[model samples]
Target: MASQAESETGRPRYVPLCSSLLPLSRLTLIVHGPEHGHRIISPVEGCRRLYIRVNGIVQGVGFRPFVYRIAVRTGLAGFVRNLGDAGVEIEVEGPAGDVKSFLSALRDEAPPLAEIAELRVEERPPTGEKEFRILASRDGGEGGGTIPPDIATCDRCLADIDDPKSRYCGYWATSCTDCGPRFTVIGALP
Candidate 1:
């Protein structure tokens, strides 16, 4: 029998993968890839995954950029998108600790005007994704779904707007995935 270390180093070496058996359950799989011009299979290929929904005043308010920042910071791989009904959806894959931290930050450090009334989370098996992204908003029934009220601009974005060289300089609409405006638009108001 191969010892843990040797077994791990060999082809198809095992690494802990996430699963639904438990909150942070680990699984193993055969990873087919290359090492020094040869194919290698990693035994430990399972990793944890999460699908989270943040509801209430989350759309149109820089939520995607905010989530992107967090994902990059936490070294997570997943995607986030806006929902027509004024909600946000996120899917992440990474170590259990990082995933949990990302969720916590989603609640505590969201954009200033982002009022997250409720956050729902579910864990699943990792899908072997390489990076995170922001997906287009989902279609909501008819009439272009109900867009939420445009949110008040955020401070970070505002500061960026003031920077002369900033790409968004002087731009009235500056958002960072955390806050901005949504829906609540009809005709010009001015």
Candidate 2:
């Protein structure tokens, strides 16, 4: 990156692209081709972790499974679990672009039952993990929110309940694609 203040002062300053910042005088700038208008390679690629803590009605709503699906699809390796506080924790490691895509999907394509109130992310050094998994839940810091008295019946479930031809219509206790009290939004989708 070029420094605005340094450029204004006189000679422009440049930020190191990789590492081992060599003096500007010793480094040579080369333009391979004008047509190559995109990044040919990632500045950094390797095991890197992003710690994400999601706060909301994330428990019992297929949130962890949802996270697993996206992580695999995004070609990432990490683990996800629910906290005792009705929150979710995830650690993803992979190419920065893929990790970024996973984050976007986490926000944009959550299960119908999930209501994300907050998503906190932190950066950590790589652990060189090779697989993505869903771990068991554990107690979280301090007191946390209580599980809802009951997860609200979702729209799809309501429809199923209302449909005369639908098998779940009469069954007061139902577990369908969208209602598990919280559904198992399968591995591929919600």
Candidate 3:
């Protein structure tokens, strides 16, 4: 079943199950779970797309939530998702600085335990979407990767929470790719 790993402040997280089992089974279980929230979307005739990949202790942790916040802050346009191999993949659009800042933050200020081994970024045409998002993990064959542990909240997110009237004000579970929870739930299942 799919579950969440909350941040220190108690924000909902996207904790994916270990993919040692069959891909189809994992997909079915995760998608069927009650807590597996998805990005709401309205049908659009056209949109842009970008592809990015981040390798490290990203899975199970609150990487998706972190990415969501980063995407919003950078005025970027794209989606971020967890990969089966303990890594993160994202696609975004905006000014070059925004993309660079986003990537820089991945390592300079990542989740508490998120040890980023590598980051692969690529730029392509836009998908015509107005906002960024976090997407459900897709079945991409066997997953022999390791799962990271839960993480603590980042300082920046915490500061944002402390500042009233901020977009993330009172967002106790505020997180970015640099800080949040991970692997705690992986042990609870199977």
In angstroms, how far off is 167's CA in candidate 2? 8.3
Considering every candidate listed, which one attains the maximal lDDT?
Answer: 2
Q: How do the residues 160-181 of candidate 1 rate in per-residue lDDT, one tens digit apiece?
A: 9999989999988687544564
- What is the Å distance of residue 176 in model 3 from its true position? 14
Per-residue lDDT for 164 in model 1? 99
lDDT of 1 at 160: 94
Whole-structure CA lDDT of model 3: 0.61
Q: Write the per-residue lDDT of candidate 3 for residues 1-190, one digit (tens) a residue.
A: 4446776867666443322222423333423224546542222212224577777666655678878887788677778877656567888765556667777776676666566776776656644455677888765623456566455786788889999878999877787655565455454421
**lDDT of each prediction vs. the true structure?**
0.66, 0.68, 0.61
Candidate 1 Cα outliers beyond 4 Å, as residue runs: 1-46, 141-190
lDDT of 2 by residue, 9-86 (tens): 575344323211233243343323334433333233333579999987677667888999999999887799887767
Please state the error at residue 40 of candidate 1 in Å.
17
Maximum-TM-score candidate:
2
How would you order the candidates by TM-score, starting with the best? 2, 1, 3
Candidates 2 and 3 compared: the better one by lDDT is 2
